[model samples]
Target: MQNDTPLYQLDPTNRFTHRTQDYDAYRPTYPSAAIDAILEDITPQTVADIGAGTGISSRLLADRNLKVWAVEPNAAMRATGSKQPNITAWEGTAEQTGLADNSMDLVTSFQAFHWFKHNDALPELQRILKPNGRLAVVWNNRDRTDEFTKRYGQVLQSVSSKPVGLGRLSDATPIRQTNPYFTNLREISIPHQQALTLEALIGLANSRSYTPQQGAAKDLLHHRLAELHRAFANNAGIAYLQYQANIFLADPA
Candidate 1:
């Protein structure tokens, strides 16, 4: 892994605590086909969802009738997920999952892998995964090619005061190289989009890890958002947000 500071590491714990409501409200859920691709030949009985926040990914796995061991480090996020039935929510990080060795057939992380210390977590993943088990990393990335989306990104940067990392699929190369445990790394890109009102769009932005706006910054964020809404909002008063679900899968080396 590169030594560069990861955006997600900025404020690990409290970043999402305040926005948990909006997160569950506006954040896009992974597509069914995306999950289906990783879960090949494996029943619902053998799955471990590391960094399972708000049960978004965990509930999907559970819906497949598989028992889900939802491991999450954040207490607030874990509490949100605990309300779901049949989800075994554990307060644990990826590096120290507290799961038995070689017990899981599939170890999955959704929109959460980049937050982990991969060197410590990869070994834990290898320990929990059974022989020939699969490791899948899935992310729904924003498609900023659209004019409105591009402007929205600019608004985000202006408000957050953090460098918006690579905005293209090619920019994800470093993430693939972050760990050496997996071989046969393959990427599947699925075209996806979400239709959202201007308010929902702001909610989505607030839920991000790098959005540090508070007090005056928070007020300024809303001001900028209003300008974006006026500029981007169409006759229907809803903006079509485009995104691609990038699912990267590999097996133990």
Candidate 2:
């Protein structure tokens, strides 16, 4: 059955409320090398992680001893992400952060920027940044070149209305020097992979916002995923999912 609910109607802020646990558990982390490369050059001391879903990106910044403000709209995600050390959770979104002016050294959205209203979000992001502060947007795009990943994507796409993959956010970022919002968008792709068992793979599928949440479609999706695992798993039953952690760094124009 096709889900008649449009993608825009999914309430981008609250859609993941029920799926937070799976998102925290199975969603791949930004590669440490990618993190290192992002932070090595500028050395931002105060950071605001926008759309900080379960603090996946927040914790990485906080771990480096940087003060990170996790800005999230959903209560559940904010509450969970707040418990992390060195993170201050705020109830806000990309378009309206409610933070004071010139308050941050860096503003980042990890695997989350695509969900924002860029026309509205850019100014708010710029308002919070100190002069010369940078904004980093990262996405671990699913690599379909690998056979197992292709089959895994097929399983998700079968039941999805909008499909489970990055849209135009896959390759290009909206931020650029010519744009009114930001200047000099620098992009890089870092190869990454995740090894998981059957259950972890199920959790991975469950974590996606567009994938089936429950009901017959959800069951069928999981069943097909398990079948894919059985068919594609290596001798040790490890299914490898490939990704390219695309990092885009820019400063407000």
Candidate 3:
């Protein structure tokens, strides 16, 4: 997601260090239905998941019995994800994965593509993907049509310095516009939802890079979110955050 924090204010790589726990604890996982849409009839033996925060999507791929290379630049996140069996977690960025050319049958970036310098990352992805290999970019976009969901967007925007992009329902317009090295762009959406407790809801807010972490903004965000939880949370102390898992699949052009 684009941030208003200019090149000077943004730490870029180190932003997620303190957020590792919240990310691992509260971040949602991609649906199996979305994964199936990306894989289709193909059977990939090796999959490289770039910008794999906490290995959420990587674990999903590994659970399908595929060898997963969980490439993440953050040491803290990589450490958390490495504990998962069948995942080779390591430090890597989308712009420079350092994987062998034509080595991977499939490459994916889940909720991380927007953070990458696509001009460089696309070529790098294209280089690593084998002939006819697929590249998938996926996001769990919040259902903003719901009243609570709309309120959540307002909360995020109120706190965020710039326009928040990840949770918004995407039509793949940005992906289609930015993709120069890939062709046959295909998109699929799978209905999904997550049950978040008050604490988890706060954790979800903290998990975002753009969310203010300290000072008055932080206090205000928390106060407003607590209010939201009070009004929208179910009897079980949970709020169902609806989402549509949007998957964009393409091949090297």
- Best by the lDDT measure: 2
lDDT of 2 by residue, 1-253 (tens): 4444433345888888988888888989888988887785788899999999898889989889899999999988776633666898888989999999999999999887767877778899999999879888888888989999988888888887766334544534457535676887888889999999999999999988889887999999989999999998899989899999999888877
lDDT of 1 by residue, 74-103 (tens): 878878733556679888888899999989
Candidate 2, residue 198: Cα displacement in angstroms equals 0.5
Better of 2 and 3 by TM-score: 2
Provide the TM-score for each candidate, comma-separated. Answer: 0.87, 0.92, 0.90
lDDT of 3: 0.83
User: In model 2, which residue pairs have backbone atoms overlapping below 3 Å?
Assistant: 182-253
Tens digit of lDDT per residue, candidate 3, span 1-253? 5444332234556778889888988888878898889889799999999989888899899988899999998888888744556789967888899899999999998987767766677889999999889999998888889888789878988987854444333445545875667888888889988888989999999988779989999999999999998999989899978888989998887
What range of 10 consecutive residues in model 2 has the weakest lDDT sum? 1-10
Q: Tell me how many clashing residue pairs each candidate has.
A: 1, 1, 0
Q: Each model's C-alpha lDDT?
A: 0.77, 0.84, 0.83
- lDDT agreement of model 1 with the native: 0.77
Measured with C-alpha atoms, the lDDT of residue 200 in candidate 2 is 97
